[model samples]
Target: MNAIAVRAATPADHPRIVDLLTRSWGETVVVGHGVRYDAAELPALLAERRGRLAGLLTYDIGSEGLEVVSIDAVVRHAGVGTALLNAAAELAWAKGLDRLWLITTNDNIDALRFYQRRGMRIEGVTRGGVDASRRLKPGIPLVGDYGIEMHDEITLEMRRPVGSGIAQPG
Candidate 1:
């Protein structure tokens, strides 16, 4: 397979990113920080392999924290997700940020494993977090992957001093 290339998304990538997020997340609206983020309009990083959109990651950096709002990969198990994650970490570290964080549903067992393996710690698990989120966007389904009821949002994070390398599996 061709090497994946990662870069900051351009305006032209909007429609495709929207489509991908819509299909991947069941919608294009992401709820975080008690507000909604239009994933397509947010600045993002895109990963391309063989000229195809391999993955995309959207984030928001602020004094509060750098939150990875969304990340999806069309090519599974091809390092697309990992590359995007590492790139996000590098960006956060460069900006002198102390941490990188994201939220995923409790039903996302795959994501839980992936994040932990990639050196992200389970910072917190807010019970009923998804329930609160649904109040903002009712489109969020009650049931999620593996037919499990979605009830909570798991917050995961990775932290390192600026200029220190992020951990990666061998």
Candidate 2:
């Protein structure tokens, strides 16, 4: 495997990111915090390996902190996700942010485990959050991977000082 290269996304990378999000989420509009974000327009970090787009992590940098709107690693278990996440956290710390956060559906046990192992903790859970999101996208499935029912949104947060390289309890 070639070494992974992570970098800030350029305007030319937008459509590819949109394509990835569309393929992964069934749409390019991500509804979160009662707002819909066009994933193609967001700031993102892209991961490249062997001249191929290996992964993407789109995020919102707000006054509070950074929110990971969507993340996809087409090449699974290849350190793509980790590289993108670290790059995002590095950006957050560079921007003087305090923390990073993201939301995953209830059925995404793999996501929960992955984020936790990376030092994130459950900050909140929006019961029936998918119901509200479905109203916006309408493509959200009633069921998800592993045949699990999708019902709620679980919020995960990492409260460590940006670039601390430490995962402390939130």
Candidate 3:
């Protein structure tokens, strides 16, 4: 993790960032669902800051608010995720966003736990969402860890109480 600092993604980081996303997704969900997609579609969202592979994050503007479409921490378990999560939330709040949310596949138990520990709550479930997503990005699969069909997407959110510190719950 040498020189691996927690900074915003830069235009230069797009290649490495996409490489990370492609490799992460290719080995991850593709074989199960039997699909494919252009990883380049993700770079615009992973905009750069200080350069290097610090991390990647993208926002989704909705009627309700801006949601976190994707988040990639350069070094897992190095507080990188927390830093990014806090940064995203602060920006969302400043811009008057109602909440910040993201989606994770069913087999991502580690991520579920990580976000949960960071005060994010499982708000909803998208049954068959994975199937729908496969139409766009076929790399997703019906099978995940332990041979479980990755049939759903879990929606997570950070809800902030007005005038409270952070939107995250303990």
Scored by lDDT, the top model is 1
lDDT of 1 by residue, 20-128 (tens): 9988878889985466888888889999998989999999987756789999999789899999999998887777877889999889999999888898988888898
What are the per-model C-alpha RMSD values against the true structure? 2.3, 1.8, 4.7
Instruction: Tell me the whole-model lDDT of each prediction, alpha carbons only.
Output: 0.86, 0.85, 0.64
Residue-wise C-alpha lDDT for candidate 3, range 1-170, written one tens digit per residue: 24334444557665676676655555312211223324344322332235545566655556756566667665677666677777777777777776878788898888899899888899888788788787766655678876778888888888766886567652
For model 1, give the RMSD to the true fold: 2.3
lDDT score for residue 126 of model 1: 86
Give the runs in model 2 whose Cα sits over 4 Å from its true position: 162-169
**lDDT, residue 86, candidate 2:** 77
lDDT tens digits by residue: candidate 2, 67-134: 99999999788899988887887787677777889989999988898888887889999998988888
Instruction: Give the clashing residue pairs of candidate 2, or none.
Output: none
TM-score of predicted structure 3 = 0.74
